[model samples]
Target: MIEANTPLLRLLRTYWPLVMLSLGLLIIVAIVDSSGDVILAQTLIEGLVRIVIVAALYLFIGNSGIISFGHIGFVMIGAYATAWQTCCPYTREMFMPGLPVYLLNNSHHFVLAIFLGGLLAAVVALISGYAIMRLSGIAASIGTFALMMVFYSIYLRWSTWTSGASSVIGLPTTTTPWVGYAYAVVAIVGAFLYSRSKWGLALRSSRDDEVAAKAAGVNVFGQRLLAFVVSAFFCGMAGGLFGHFLGMLTVDSFGLGMTFITLSMLVLGGMQSLTGAVVGVVVLSFLIDILRRLENGMVSGLNLPTSSAEVFVGIVIILILMFRQSGITGNQEVYWPFKGDVSASSAMKRQS
Candidate 1:
């Protein structure tokens, strides 16, 4: 058993493998990108952004065993919030003229704008979680989906603020592979720490057996809310990064299509494991990119239709689910050779 007084250093040591593996993958990608392959670099940035978003999803969905379709809504909020703060005065004046003087007059730094964007999503999550967390099973899932629709509708119709359904242009193209790599590392560390923390354990317990967890005095609702808000914050930051990466935003970018893609990535990776989230995003993103290139006739002599990539992805998801419903990693973390005995002992204790 881990002692209550276990040193922080010990905890950090236990999770070092996870951190190392994550960083190692990013380093390999960075090296390849250094060859000046712009397409590869963009793909790496997109993969890193997906990693951040999927990691956020894992924090809540993995621990709580809840599926939330509304997270993309938070991403939309963050992206637009970042745009509002970072766009030049002239751009904001022309596109979003209804803004207050503070937002209209000042163009903030990218870092500050991204931070505020994440914070904004967190606040929204907290407010919505109060009511949504009360629900469970399919009801909670539906409620979250409804929340997404609400966000989508509001952003689509709020013409003065969001430019309605039209794409919002003039965002700074500031997200590079290195910037994405740094954020991805931070997100991995945060997810790892939280997963090993007491609250995360409690939430997982509640997820596995709500009745027993409640009987043990775990505040399931509160724990779920905490996870939800934390997840939203990182996801929002990812949205900010994505907006800057693309230099544009539209309701379609954060709508059902995006939600489906991100959720598919999470599910493919083993939604219950942090390592799975990273691996899933990296593998699927690369696969999609390759398929897209093939469709564009970059490799082979045959040029397939644009929809071929989507078709292939859909088929892959179906096959994976049919074979490994729990995902590529199941509920296990990445392998740490020296910690085998420790993990075995913990499993024995839990069973007894």
Candidate 2:
């Protein structure tokens, strides 16, 4: 018989929630790959990419009870950063002549470039968040929105570097379903670890009541800034994956349209819970895929406009907000259902 007090059993009891989520994702990926359908597989990869983005958003917004409209700006920063290191050297020399000689002359591996993209975005977040995180409530949200707009305008006008409203092509198409899946898993684990960390708990305390958190000796601003930087890192990596997946980058692709859609997914999924983020992405992605097919006339005798999916998604969001404000997961994490002593399960968790 298995020993109940053994380390292995304790580990399992502590992390059963993560194990279950990971297995569920793996099963979905396996089924899709087994079908041998290229279009569906491609869509699956895209959905996984969104999971990374939405999960990163949840790391900050969910824990801090803050909304951000400019996180997509970090995504744009990361995409072009990857483009700089992974795009063709010849294209760089011709179109992005303003790039430093080192970058213009050499191209790096996509994996290295992707990581560098995230690092650069994190650096930007560190700088901007220092100021933005000082503001609370809606002011901070507006600050992020402004940051995104500033990024959009700069990228739009920076012709010699970002192609100036033109598409930056020749990025190696290296993002396969497996690659996307790996990154998505990494994102989930990273978010979970952070959520359980002391910093995460402190930030959430401040989120719920800033005054009380301050009375308890928490560095509210510091916690917010830390979460912001970490969240940006994952978002930037997602942007790199997005660029490679499509083999092209455009400023317009990272604008308001993307910002709103991602925010909508986060809110729909229950911005206060990580499980909600993943579930929201999966459900909405599936819905969009079906709606897209209908829009493309997949069904005989059916007519739908090109933007029907967006309209339908908006309607769904309205209904969700009106009926279930806490989101589908009710702001709750997936827990070990068999555990009779829930406190013991929590106590068994080792601090990261």
Candidate 3:
């Protein structure tokens, strides 16, 4: 039997598996970097960003039981926000001449830029989530998809601010594997803490039974909106990291393809648990990388078509959903010492 402990200690106990998994990935990244493979290093950086993004998704969707397609809209906003604050003066002047005098004239530090980017996205989420969270089920999902389309259309046309369909260039590229690793750790820890918090419990209660939760005095909409804003903050930071990683930003980069990819990662890993998000991203990322190698004839004599990776991923997703809709983790987290199933009653009591 487990002894009663402080919330912090219990939180750590419940999430130690996730923490160790992240540390293990960081070690792998270090090993890859040590091997002097710049290409692998870059790919790992990309995977790290996906881990952050998917973790953000889990923090909101997993706890709240809401599926949002518009989270990537926050990502777009964050990327351009970082670009506006960090891009060179000449680049801004040349591409975004109509920007405010303060933004147009000065470039900020990368850290500050990332913070502001995330802050901006969080602010937007706060405003938008008020209405969006009031919606439920497929309607809520559609509302979010509409929000994404609106953002996409505006970014595609607002040339002065977003450079229209063109890419925003000349931003600093300072994201190393270490930096990505740091953010991934932050994402993992932050998500785990939130999942075990009072608000998280209340949200999950509402998710499981809205009528009972309402009877118990839970404010479902408020909880959902709170999660939305917090999730957007991390997603925004992911976007900023992505911008700095690639040193470029385009509206299309955060469009439908990105939405589907991240959602797939979340669903494939198990949408109900944090471990699912991390495992899903790592597994699928490596799978895609391996398929890409095969496509390039790097693996034996097999030379698959350029689009084979996507096809394989789609097939795999279908198979997983058909056989195990809860994903690889089956809506359960990875616990320490032994991989045993955790019941909801125990989790709730521990949080209490």
Best lDDT among the predictions, by candidate number: 2
Runs in model 3 with CA error above 4 Å? 1-12, 338-352
- Candidate 2, residues 1-352, lDDT tens digits: the string is 4433668777775676578777888998999999998878878988898899999999999998889998999999999999999887666777678899889888899889989999999999999999999999999999999999999999999989999888888888889888999999999999999998999999999999999999999999999999999999999999999999999899999988888788778878888988889888888888888888899999978868899999998998899889998888877777655544355336656432
Off by over 4 Å in 2: 1-6, 343-352
Local distance difference test, each candidate: 0.86, 0.89, 0.88
Worst 10 residues of 2 by lDDT: 336-345
Segments of candidate 1 deviating more than 4 angstroms: 1-13, 344-352
**Clash count, one per candidate:** 0, 0, 0
Q: After superposition, how far is residue 144 of candidate 3 from its true place, in Å?
A: 0.8
Predict model 3's lDDT versus the native: 0.88
- Name every residue pair that clashes in candidate 2: none
Model 3 over residues 1-352: C-alpha lDDT tens digits?
Answer: 4542668656666667677778788787889889998768878899998889999999999998889999999988888998899986676888887799999988899888888998999999999999999998789899999999998899899999988899888878888888888889888988988988999999999889888998999999999999999999999999999999999888989998889888999999999989899889989988888888889898777899998988898898899889998999888776554333255645776899
Worst 10 residues of 3 by lDDT: 336-345
